[model samples]
Target: MAADDGVVLDEGAVVLEDAPPSNLDKLENSPPSNLDKFLKRFRALNPHFVRDDAEKLVCFFGDSDISHWKELPRVRITGDEGASWARCVNVGVGGAEMLHVAFYSAECRAKYRPDVVVLCAGENDLGAGAAPPTVFSYLEKSIAAFGHLDDATEQAQLRLRHDPQRTRDNANVVSSLPIDDTKSQQQDGMNASEFSRLRNNNTDEKVPIVYLCTKPEPVADAELRREYERYDGRIKELFQRYNSSCQEELLYFIDNSDLRDPSLYAQDGLHLSRQGYQVWDARVRDAVERVLLKMDERVLAP
Candidate 1:
């Protein structure tokens, strides 16, 4: 009936002029025609930041799947007992991997300084046909980068406390450190020590890291499904490795792989419907409760 630009179309590639701009905008904005807009809307539903009524902060970071995280209406809060957090920011971007997370972490903490971050990634890494160790290696680097920032912040804070005037003079330089960049794209400059400090703080009281295993994915049997499955197994293995390296009380993992109901997915066997999102919402809440338990143990243990 109409060409994409709102010009009327006749059968043989002929287009009629005089189409209204109003009509043109609608056609141009159509979901199929404007994938960027659709993706933006989809990602926006997952806010990257939300004010926390409770003192503690929580956030989600990863790729598209995490971008859709806020679609889950409710979130579970630990330590508060009866309290709950509304929602935090969703920083997921399309095709983001652990390297992206590592890079973004340097950016995110510099900006928001959220106390808790919920990550749902590895999907993109696995989907890209990465080997297990290769993906985990990147993830390891990313985690280290996160700790690196924590170390910098701690050192800066300590220096400020020791000599407020001296710190004031040097604050610019300290803040200018590459770890302070919140712009996501600027973290490529981090070096090895910068990376190791991120993991070194595993048991540090100030900056505790929580890594959630990826959610369960549908077995779509697409051309890339087997490849995806291989990566999925790798993800679990990484979690196991991280958990084993430390006492369970220090580093904990909650398995929400089966949280979303199989029925909630779209027929394509890959994304989710609104109902499916609700299931994920519930899963994250439960997982948070578990994470809180671990945190409490770490804090309360003698």
Candidate 2:
């Protein structure tokens, strides 16, 4: 059965009968051992803290969910064994679109001077009924802004010339636009091929990475399920174009679309659950590690 809020419920509460148990649950249920207490204290004192000797600085720019996720990417990366050497700065603004994200990223870059920028926005733009060109243009502008390219002059010219190389050199990693089950119509505003063209046309040197987080399957609402079925193929096609066009070194695609497990999602069915964010955290951490390793190699080559 479903709740008045449209959340699927089994008996009295929302439950995940078919999903595997999450590690978070184990941590929650187990008594706090000495080591667990120590770790908990350490995390409480400095949840988003990075060591002074950290190798790289990562900045995240995205929507409200990115800002408020149970574990922000920065905190997750800081705690990761492989990625602990990196520092993180999160500048995610709730309810932001590509345009707002670009502006904030530019501001954050000036202050933090991050070596890597991860973008997890654009859904709001689609929700707002923006056209494909409009959405793409905002993305381009945001990329340029974060790269420290002069916005007023460069953004105008970029639309005409559309230099993909400039963006590629900026050390930006953009997450692909995910499919939202709630939206009946296409949220991306553009078709897959056109989106592909816009993205490919702007590339050149291939240093920046594109991370694709696939949408979840099995939306509970029948109406929403129908909507997802209609758009899922096109979303997959867009992701394919992004992955196929880029060198393996420059693209990191996380295919969660086949994930039908309701436990991975929040009550809304649109956002990710704590477990889902954990999945994202691991993938993004790996991608950032690869980028940092490649960068280190480049620096040491000379």
Candidate 3:
């Protein structure tokens, strides 16, 4: 157990002594970054900026449910096969809780510059005996890490971006803009035109985060599932509040159907089976399609 740091969080939130250290030096040895290894592998896979038809990145992160999903790029983006499509990577760690995601939230965005991020965690947090309060704290931290903008400020930025005076001379600011899709995107070896697309004045996009609610699992009994459901509701309510603050149209959820369908689970009654992954993959791809397609419409619209 971690020693108390002598602090408490919000009403439902609690601070853990063993939580990932915020200091740069203490972090050299203490709690190790689990995502660091995985990110290295991903960066190596994508040696250079993807100038291929795959123009956008859609990242998926979570526990085994997300880690196990191995989807390829089959979803087409437009009539022109030459147009850019979505590239995806699953940065899930098998036993990760929302704490891991919260701690590494900024790095997650920096690495991929993903246009869309689908997050499916917290199941293991509940499974590992974390109470609803703990999960809420985890979620609050994760959402805040994304730098959620106040509605008024966000709207003001959007309005300003759309204003003719501001957008009419994108060429002028293009040379001066510090960051957009990401500082890393430019650093990743993309040229000037590539960086400019990220600042596309049309969407005012902010790498929307998609929230995937914890699904009912057969490994958990009815009572446990009920507890999971209750926790899910609370965490989802929290997610929606944060998601609502800065979200585009992105919801192709699996909880829409009978959640306990055994066909979805493998023989282990926990990890998803081939059929289950198919269902999840399709829904995720559909969500990605909607977001990208909408952005296309927004850009093309008069």
Candidate 4:
């Protein structure tokens, strides 16, 4: 069994702020009423369907894992509790791959300008027999979509607004300090808060991509070990490379790979159970807080 507190990290904003209103209410107060109404109506009319940006603009992409996450709406909101939030619209299709995430165009990011993007994949890529180079190549293309310059016209409107005096100890800095460079390595020292600021702030840098890493699962079978060895290892390596390439640019990774519970799996020793989801949720909350803190430090820095 993984430690009882395996999911708990040393520093993170655990106390969630009041949950934001449903996406429907947010849309009620926005422009292009007709478009918003159409989206709301469509989601309301269909079962097992999800929608995005009813209030704020945000985009999410992955495969089945992310796609299913939409079904579980957040009861408690983490990160910058009161700042601003966006309803995630999963572009994930079950059994999708990294290449799918890269090759498949996400109109939402272009249209809504999300404050953050949650990317989860690779399992499917390995299942599909993707080579190591192919996997890394896909990630390279995907990250590049965020633009590759400190000052780019396409990403000029991004901003990192923060009220420094509000927090007691500038919680942002506390959350963003590098943890383990070897374990969660990346280019530059950009932590969670920095990524959040880049996404929310008015800057010329491309949209900050938060690379969410999958947790380590129990691999009792040789086949499972082989699968994990190829896909999981490649994903981590590729993320490190991306981080190194964009050290000064706006790019970062969130290591949730440490949030798994070995005992939560079934006899097959693969996949997360309900309890496992709880563990993953905690890590997600931490990443959100880190992003907020990074953004706050950048905006309020003296």
Candidate 5:
């Protein structure tokens, strides 16, 4: 959660803002987007995803769990001798709710029609009191929002135009607050060529989307854990129906039953410690490898 302090620290991120220390004075609301500050920091840290080689990228979107799994990409790429197999980018933002997932990955989603997109959200959404149906609605919105490659472009535009819950605390920050203005604001202008090319090449491409079921963590109470279970059940039930009908598999549901044990989590009770991360890393790697292998077989077939 954001606070009066100038430093916004998540389990894996520390975002600094140049604001007055005194909340006794007039308060300054954060930018309208839940992901504004985090995105700024990410862009500064990893500009190459947008600028340089992002071939065979597997982009992950979630909260701190994904963000905190900072080594997943590098460790694999190192083993593969510097991404000969694939590269990765983690666009997870700590404290991000379910609704924020798609928007957080929109740029990469648009730019690199990644070989795979893995989503690891929903626990935070449920913990925040959203019903299972509501959390699922956010997932549905994300799935629909990126049905086509062009939809990613539209999502970026829509983000600029509309931010939900804007009427209450929406105050324009000073121009000096560059973090408030998205990198999208600076980069959307150069995107005409990129998008135009994407529009032509991928008019009908259906990218694979993987939804990693919500994990039971220590932060949520018993009722919240139950809600997490309900959300996961809803996800499994709905995707099973979708998978059964579709000839070509586009949606995948990965279960997290192995992660139910409390010992897997760190002492903080939110993030996964090394032991828990071992489980998470395996889940992510297995999903990515399966997607890549499927792609390889298709390309090599007569």
Candidate 6:
């Protein structure tokens, strides 16, 4: 349970703003035309079925934090030197972990044919009591699953976008193991170090680039906070390894733990507030620009 300040709503309901009628009931009762427009916009923001004709397609895959990107106003993607660039597509699903993200990655590659994919996961696996090796394996597998596919199969999947009846499977694999709320705090920092060493030695590159976001520290009960801090530390360490690894500049990590200000969090202390989403949008835009610049530079160098 979150603190009183956290955003709390009934199951199957989403709070778009800090006001009345935050439930889906209002949407359900709206006129057909209004509902059609709303659904169209929602589908546009979350393009799981069809692919837009954007020159540069970027897909964001993760949990609630990634899903919240839809709440932010669109921002121009200016490169590192302020030259405008590409737009992004959000394929986030709340409560998703690496397993779910991996599945979605395949779908995004086949349908959207994204030029870049941002993966934000692992924290939930850590919170769910997954061992460090297990977590690392999941991350590696997810990245690998996004690797190049056969041309014919890829084209077939891409053509499916034209089929109006084509639908996406939303099922996810859930772990039944009880969460170890305090287990992270009990371990020495050695696990993070080992994970970092293993990750750096792999020198793996699965896609053009995989933008990873470090887990933010949770602002909840004392026990949960401690565990989150430990998990966050591991993420930072893993990011450092990613930077030092000899792989191509195909994996970039962004640290967003600083955005943990109380005012930026909803009552649940898990999701972001509207203001928080704005801040996140700015950071993500900057990172995307940097990546685009690097890609351009690499292309022009030869």
- For each candidate in the order shown, give its overall lDDT on alpha carbons: 0.45, 0.45, 0.51, 0.43, 0.54, 0.48
Q: Can you give the TM-score per candidate against the true fold?
A: 0.55, 0.53, 0.61, 0.53, 0.64, 0.58
Clashing pairs counted in every model: 8, 3, 0, 18, 0, 6
Q: Candidate 3, 202: how far from true, in Å? A: 12
Candidate 5 stretches with Cα past 4 Å from truth are 1-45, 50-54, 73-83, 148-204
Displacement of residue 77 (Cα, Å) in model 4 is: 8.4
How does residue 294 of candidate 4 score in lDDT? 60
Clashes of 4: 18
Best by lDDT: 5
Worst 10 residues of 3 by lDDT: 154-163
Candidate number achieving the greatest TM-score relative to the actual structure: 5
Full-model lDDT, candidate 2: 0.45
Write model 1 residue lDDT over 1-302, tens digit each, in one string.
Answer: 11122322221121112222123233324412323443444345435444444455556766666664545445556554666554456666644555345445555655556655666556454444444334444454445444523434321110011122322111112112111124323324334454333334445533344455554445433443433333444334334444454435323344544544777765544456677777666666666556665666767889
Relative to the unseen true structure, what is the C-alpha lDDT of residue 239 in candidate 3, on a scale of 0 to 100? 38
Which one wins by TM-score: 2 or 6? 6
The residue ranges of model 4 lying beyond 4 angstroms of the native Cα positions read: 1-58, 70-86, 105-108, 148-205, 214-220, 223-227, 230-250, 256-263, 266-270, 299-302
lDDT of 1: 0.45
Q: In model 5, how large is the Cα lDDT of residue 108?
A: 50
| Per-residue accuracy of model 6 over 20-70 as CA lDDT, tens digit each | 112223423542233333233334444445566646667776666677766
Residue 74 displacement in candidate 1 (angstroms): 3.2
Error of 3 at 219 (Å): 1.1
173-250 per-residue lDDT for model 2 (tens digits): 222323323442333344444434434333332334333332543344443333333232232333344446443344
